[model samples]
Target: MYHTWMRFFTPSPLHRRLGLVCLGVGLQHGTLPTVGPRTLDHHVAVVISAGSGWYRFPDGRRTTVTAPALLWLTPGVPHHYAPDPGTGWDEGFVDFTGPVTATYTELGHIEPDRPVVPLADAGGPRSVIGRIARAARRGNPLLEVETSAAVHELLVALRRARADTNADGDLVLEALARDACRPLTVAEHAARHGMTPAELRTAVRRGAGCSPKDYLLGIRLGRAKELLAATELPVAAVARRVGYDDPAYFSRLFTRRVGTAPVRFRAQQGRTVPGGWSTRIPDAEHPPTIITGHV
Candidate 1:
């Protein structure tokens, strides 16, 4: 299911702008070594595409390593890592160093404190490493510069790949689905998921093909209809139950959106048609919406 290799690099920087230069590049999968903890003079980024492992830090802090993640081996840090034999990882690594690397750390772009960064784009790191490996193999003129360019790109890719897992739109959708009746603003919903309103809107639009506010309203209306049909709750009670503080406003909105008032809609559902009472909810013109919302 997997294959790999490890390559060492010896790049001579062709220019100063090529701040970060690759020292070595390696690819490994399903391999284990019983070597002791080692300290390196150069920084190495190990991208894991599959399987799991563990990384032991110099401070004696050990962290679990999972696939689709980045394990950063910072310079002068005593660290050791190995793939789980039962589920050895598909790994691609690049050893790099330069003055710009320190700048990267200061900018919080490369988090030395966080050794394990779970990757969001599973194929991204692998692709970067694959490019570096191919460059290393060719041993072309300006290989140093070419690899250095790739090294910079690698860092950027790694950073992008380590997106906040919680900020993902699916989580927001799940939360909204769970409590659509909760009275919360769009900003509050986004904040709950560690995102800004704009970010939440973009994510929701991409994931649900609808605005966050619209989605929330959809869920609220859906829940309100359920309560009106399944329960004996009054109009005002149903309005409040579905997050509307003022029953008059709820009734007006319900009438506008549903093509009928809430009371009449409930009555229609209560009356028997031929075999069953089929009260069509509002928005039949639109496709079924995911009426759930969460931050």
Candidate 2:
């Protein structure tokens, strides 16, 4: 047996900092719309819980995204999609806007001109969205923070999807992920893979579903998230450890990819501050971390 629920959040003038909408649907045996391509007013994260569907973008690119896959919809992108007529579909989705939404928009990851990028593993995201829906239904005060974190998790999943698609891409991404916490360059990575930088870029795009540079940046950003969440390390140190010698540049990249400055992200995670100041410190007891950082 399957059940469905949906929640909608209207923008409140009193609460200017956050916005959210959640939708859950269970089709025992039904069909979705065959509407023409339409643009969204805000960003959307879709998780297919059961059955499968076909998505078509304005550019004519099409992909059959199945259950346990995610769809990212950027505002203003023309897209049209429908569920598999026979199997019907069960899905959950959340739409949100905040500082992080703007950041995603700026990073080009939320492509307004392209179709949704399917997450390799949609289970985590689906679970998070479910939680968000429940929280909203209960009118939880922490909904803003929870929804924001859930969206971040979804974004991280998308980045992993981009890197873990095919074997060749996995090799390049694995190499990048391994060295992301250290200083690494495109040429150096290419040499390690026995290919020129150009060839490596092409290979990465085909295999990982994104360019080599984007893949490396994703790796570094993923690491930055770990330091922000687990350690009291200063943003500067976190930047350096993640291969950015310049803290300011790292801040920009982090804000762009993560939708908040490193300091803010940590604060949102409920870390304590000292006399209104938060300094980053390494965690002695924390185990060696993975690139995903639990996102």
Candidate 3:
């Protein structure tokens, strides 16, 4: 693998909202900088397209990052990196600042210090970033939409990377996801798959990067997020649907996991849970106005 670092800057409403500095990265070759340590003004995400390298933070913490790895640098974090002595590095990075940056921060995808997350495989993130870069270069009117979609795909790929590490662990996770609404203990789940609870737990930890209980909680929380965003269900009803009988407990859990209460989340999204299940529509005295003209 080769080693390299590149940066992109862009100016657009979408980019401004996302705090993204550049778009449409291209393949390039360069020597790693030997400059003094510095902190970025915005979030920086680095995707190694090719190569391996060693990275160091101002705190003197260091980690060797390989190609197909992702490096996240939150604003005000002091960091510097260099290519490996023998094998150079090839990488692309973008700087962004925006409302959605907090979302990534909450997901732990962005690190305050230098943290390199190795991908399951290189191709997925590379393709996504490459496509976004290409679209940005084209300067199309829909660049924002395309870039946002690509960024989302990149995030999903990163999330799935953890699930891809263990053998058959991804399949087990998939099975669990299919039945997330149902309550099942580790032993019961393992018994259905001919594996012991201990073995299942180990596999889950390896694949999900969390304990079985934590994984289950994540599933419940994800379902809660959907309900909060898309439905008019009361917090209690949503909690019950996700397996929590006590709305207070569910509210606390939601706050811990989602960083907000269910009601606030819905409100922020400009939605409301209609009370009493009424299907009322305002009656209009006049028909809606429509204009039709022949060209």
Candidate 4:
């Protein structure tokens, strides 16, 4: 015998264009019945938080599942799994699909080949699943967007939870991100780590799912955006701080990726402190709205 709760969604074509849309979510425990040797048209992430189970491979091999593990059921891929008969398991899963799924896969967030992945902890993924569940309530106006956002969070959580990479403590990624502001090439970065460029590339791919240059650019651009929005520094100073010596080049790249020039972004975001606190405070009842971004 087993216990289960689940909800399914049929999102509109427009919702799907939002990059990642959740199709379903569920919680299951106990000695669940066997699932099919079946195929699907989308993807599902079954986060097993406790107990153990087993799943079948396309070639008919069976792999054992343990607590704090993940099962990636991808589109057009056959899957069959069940919890251990007596001990059973607690599992939370989210089903999602969209154009961004391809990018996530390229970045190694969605591993179709590695169906079962061991996790360092289930707490993070479980939390994201909870968010999806709460957002799944019927007639909720923001259901689609909320759940879709949660799906993105779930992917990051899963990536961080991976037992092997352990993205949170990944020394390589951490070092790269730490030195992201340095004007260094991928090869130079590799040399500093005593790794060949190819080896460093492979490591970054396994840990962060992107090439070294791309990863560094992502970090650099992110910091440039923060400086542009919050700091009073000029564009050239901001560019230098983010490892770009040439302000014009930095502006071009920033505009290409962010779809806006640095000066324009700053204008739109405005200053949070606005030349420090004013001597006169605004009325409490009519306090102005404030906004900020992580990037």
For each candidate, give its TM-score against the true structure: 0.54, 0.58, 0.57, 0.84
Model 4 misses residue 15 by how many Å?
3.0
What's the residue-level lDDT of 86 in candidate 4?
A: 86
Pitting candidate 3 against candidate 4, the one with the higher TM-score is 4
- Determine the backbone clash count of candidate 2: 5
- Model 2, residue 53: displacement in angstroms? 3.1
CA RMSD of each candidate after superposition:
15.2, 8.7, 9.7, 6.0
Q: Predictions ranked by lDDT, top down?
A: 4, 1, 3, 2
Model 4 / residue 172 / CA error / Å: 1.3
Estimate, for each residue in 1-295, the C-alpha lDDT of model 1 and write its tens digit.
Answer: 4465766766544564578888888887775563358888889898888888888877888778888888888877777888876787777889998899987886455778887888877687788888988888664777788888999889877766775634666678878766667778888888788989999888776445578888888888888887677556678988987888899999999999989999989888744243333334333235455668875
lDDT of model 4, residue 101: 96
Clashing pairs in 4: none
Query: Each prediction's Cα lDDT score?
Result: 0.78, 0.66, 0.66, 0.89
Judge candidate 4 against the unseen true structure and give its global Cα lDDT, from 0 to 1.
0.89
Lowest-sum lDDT 10-residue window in model 1 = 275-284
Which tens-of-lDDT digit does each residue in 11-45 have in candidate 2? 45544454432222221224665535888767676
Better of 2 and 4 by TM-score: 4
Candidate 3 lDDT over residue span 246-277, tens digit each: 89998998898788888988788634336521
Better of 1 and 2 by TM-score: 2
